[model samples]
Target: MQDGTVERMPRQDDAIRNLTMVVYILQIVNLFGVPGAIVGVIINYVKRDEARDTLWDSHFSWQIRTFWWALLGAAISYPLIILFGLGFLTGALVWCWYVYRIVRGFLAFNDGKPLPR
Candidate 1:
């Protein structure tokens, strides 16, 4: 400690706000499925530091994992959609849930609340 020097604390609200923006942007991309996954990876890589926070690390990690899963799901579902229409629907639903989780986690993190395990 020094005179005229102040330590800065991490702002939970700011982290949540930034994450909320990321989730909304991702939701828009998610509509396009695999293409959205690619965009998400790019966005996440570019904003990795901003996306990082003590309370939100799990959320960010899950976002990356879900992106990969959606990417794989899209690739697998495309060729099987004809034989198994349900594959496409299932992938879309999973992707939607992934986005929903991100939003929920962001809100929770912003409120300085513990995440549900």
Candidate 2:
């Protein structure tokens, strides 16, 4: 401790923590629309300072993008399946892909690798 010196917390780490929490919270909302994805994008942008150190930022970005796409896929596929009598396969595939993206993102984040692009 030095005179007139106050220890400062790491801003990057704080941003990472906040962004990660936001992503998890949004996951539970289940709407998975552009609005939610936009929040995720905002979180990532706010936390970009830590993106290099924490791969989670990249993963979060990917998750947000994938979520939006998955939602679109569901919107297009569900009605077609019902009207054409294709069963639930299309919807199920979209859901499975969404889950895969989220899980893969989590794994990459936890692996401590450098952020992708």
Candidate 3:
């Protein structure tokens, strides 16, 4: 080595955090669609074991729940729309809830805090 010093790269957990945050932001911008959410959830699953006992555990749990719940919301609303045309309101509310979760989780992550119980 030139100076007997080594550069340290970012840790695995840090990479997971950063990548997850990027996925959230992309979703917020509507540039991601379902594909991005799936990618984020996959990362969450892969790193979940590593995140045990850490604040990231909550974040991962919250994120995965968000995805499933949001999907359920959409599915429920679709039938309502087809059968009664009242699904618009339900869909809108679900969209808002999804956005709220993303923003809340993103902020908590940046502040190094766990999601609320």
Candidate 4:
């Protein structure tokens, strides 16, 4: 109000938005890898019920889907790599796709845009 801003965000929304970024950052860091990502997903799921009425719910959904699909890709492709030496390419492509999704979601969150379903 002192700055004469027309609108202000609630503290809860701010926290949700910040946490969304943390999840994405943890995944991209790759040292935590999927396990770190799993932690993020668990947080998302636990907070998701509270998030249901807020804009940040979209982020939770986006992150959860991203984690599962990436896991599926790794599970399927790694075996191919181990057995036939052919899954490496697929695995790399999947990883790239996951990165893209994470970046896209982050950008949307930053821009205050709703993620596409």
Clashing pairs in 2: none
Q: Worst 10-residue stretch by lDDT in candidate 1?
A: 32-41
Writing each residue's lDDT as its tens digit, candidate 3 over 14-92 gives 8767766766665565423545777767777887787777667788888889888988998999999989999999988
Give stretches of model 3 more than 4 Å off. 1-6, 29-34
Would you list the C-alpha lDDT of every candidate in the order shown? 0.62, 0.65, 0.79, 0.84
Q: What is the number of backbone collisions in each predicted candidate, taken in the order shown?
A: 0, 0, 0, 0
The segments of candidate 2 whose C-alpha lies over 4 angstroms from its true place after superposition are: 1-8, 28-57, 114-117
Root mean square deviation (Cα) for candidate 2: 4.5
Runs with alpha carbons beyond 4 Å of true place in candidate 1: 1-20, 32-37, 49-53, 109-117
For model 3, state the Cα shift of residue 50 in Å.
1.6
How do these models rank on TM-score, best leading?
A: 4, 3, 2, 1
Question: Comparing 2 and 3 by TM-score, which wins?
Answer: 3
lDDT of 2 by residue, 14-111 (tens): 66755775774565355454356556656666666666556465666675577668778878888978798553788878878877766666666566
Q: Give the range of the ten consecutive residues with the poorest summed lDDT in model 4.
A: 26-35
Residue pairs whose backbone atoms clash in candidate 3: none
TM-score, candidate 1, is 0.55
Model 1, span 1-117: residue lDDT tens: 578888888776566556545654674566754355456566656666665655555555556666677667767777777777877787677667766765775566567564543
Model 2 clashing-pair count: 0
